[model samples]
Target: MASAENESLDHVPLFPLNAAVLPGGRIPLQLFEPRYLDMLAGCLREQRGFVVVLLREGSDVGSQAVFYDIGTYVRIVDFQQLDNGLLGITAEGLWKVAVNRSWRAPDGLNLGDAERLPEEPEDVLPSGHSELAAVLRALLRHPVINKLDLSVDFSSAREVGWRLTELLPLDSQEKQRLLEIQDPLQRLDRLSSLLDAMD
Candidate 1:
């Protein structure tokens, strides 16, 4: 376990994306830009994690983009050279972090001073939440989703919330709000409510 003090002191390399990755969720990135390729090499070499923040404004082509302060720190788990020679990287989100400040490097890569948020404590799943798990299982039945190998324990409250958040087609802002939530049970309840409204 990492102390809160140590966690807050850790700085992270930033990669702003139009997508959101909740804690426990995994996302695949296509790396082509020179800055990102270099960042990927360094992360792979050092076995370090990087933060993925949702792009609030600007484009991925340049470092001028504005991003949400809430982000996820992810570790690369799979990497491959794509047919077009670009780097195809798969990273699993491990920590939810709050970006205290951000700046662009001379090389065009973005970096952030971040503080890791406290993880939600373990809690038992509430009753009548089987529908949530069922929905996720149905989604897994899809060929595309099944191929991703998203291993999850539906019985776990935290996994259930995070995985559902990942599988849902909610917009980036909605997903960011869920990622910033610190309570797993409340997250689940909110998700359930959202799904109910959707229905």
Candidate 2:
């Protein structure tokens, strides 16, 4: 399964943002920078995808932007031209990946060589973990996040964990840390604890 998963692609263009995107997640982006515009065009033309990572350092645009080692595989699902002429893209996050190495292209696009991380199975949500879905459902009611149009699967602990990670207003570093965790139950437990602390 690991080999089959990794066989899709080894390298992708990296888009560093101030947030993390988990598997089974989606986010919208506005493309204005020349480098990113070209990258998006290539992905659309070739039917390929790009990596969305959290910025560890530097701005999303311009040089010297460093990103976390983990990211999500994203495919453009919908797109349109904004009134300002920027490209608006809605990308669905497919899977988690660990970036092994990266470099800057002449156009300043960062390309990452990444490997697919194995996804955890859909284990039953342990007792106490069911509250995770409840918490997420409450957050989903917000006007801003509701527009994300997330689909929930309460039976799968892994799905619940990823949705919670994406919905919470955690900082980029905190979200990146969650993305690195390999155990779904542990991620869910940690997220539940973090939410408890916030309450």
Candidate 3:
């Protein structure tokens, strides 16, 4: 991962979806549209990644979609041609970035000038938040989540918070708020409150 000191605001391809992905989470995508297919090819050929922003307005299949400015920058970890003839890709979120400005290419692909956000500092899960880790462990056991083969680090506050945000039944707006938070401990606290309310 590139350190914040070395990172700068640069134009990157953007993919807007109804879902949100946080750093350390992974999402599987199916590409059939010509615009996105071309974007995938460029990213793979350049060995680079694209931003996955949560759509705020319009449809994902159209050219007029609007998205939240903060999003995850993901790299394509795996790719294959599905039996249905669509391109299947597994993307792992590398970090968070804020889109300063955006434009559309002639091909109808969205591009953004994004600045990488600083990574959360390493912090151990506090003893009071042990329940949060336990809850995440249980959630990860679900067959659907297990199939993703995600790596979990219960000792890391950031890991636990991010995984829980991805796994929980929170709305996209709620998840986006968590993603924008810079402090892992605070995020964990927020998740705990959310879980308590869900019960």
In model 3, the runs with Cα more than 4 Å from the true position are 1-9
Enumerate clash totals for all models, in the order shown: 0, 0, 0
Tens-digit per-residue lDDT, 135-171, candidate 3: 9999989997887789988999999999998789888
Error of model 3, residue 92, in angstroms: 0.6
- TM-scores, in order shown? 0.90, 0.92, 0.93
lDDT at 11 for candidate 3?
A: 69
- C-alpha-based local distance difference test score of model 2: 0.84
What lDDT does candidate 2 reach at residue 34? 92
lDDT of 1 by residue, 32-114 (tens): 99999998887777668789998888886766898899888888889899998888999888878888988888898888888
* lDDT of residue 32 for candidate 2: 92
Cα-lDDT of candidate 1: 0.82
Residue 138's lDDT in candidate 1: 94
| Model 1, residue pairs in steric clash | none
- lDDT leaderboard ranking: 3, 2, 1
For model 1, the superposed segments whose C-alpha errors exceed 4 Å read 1-11
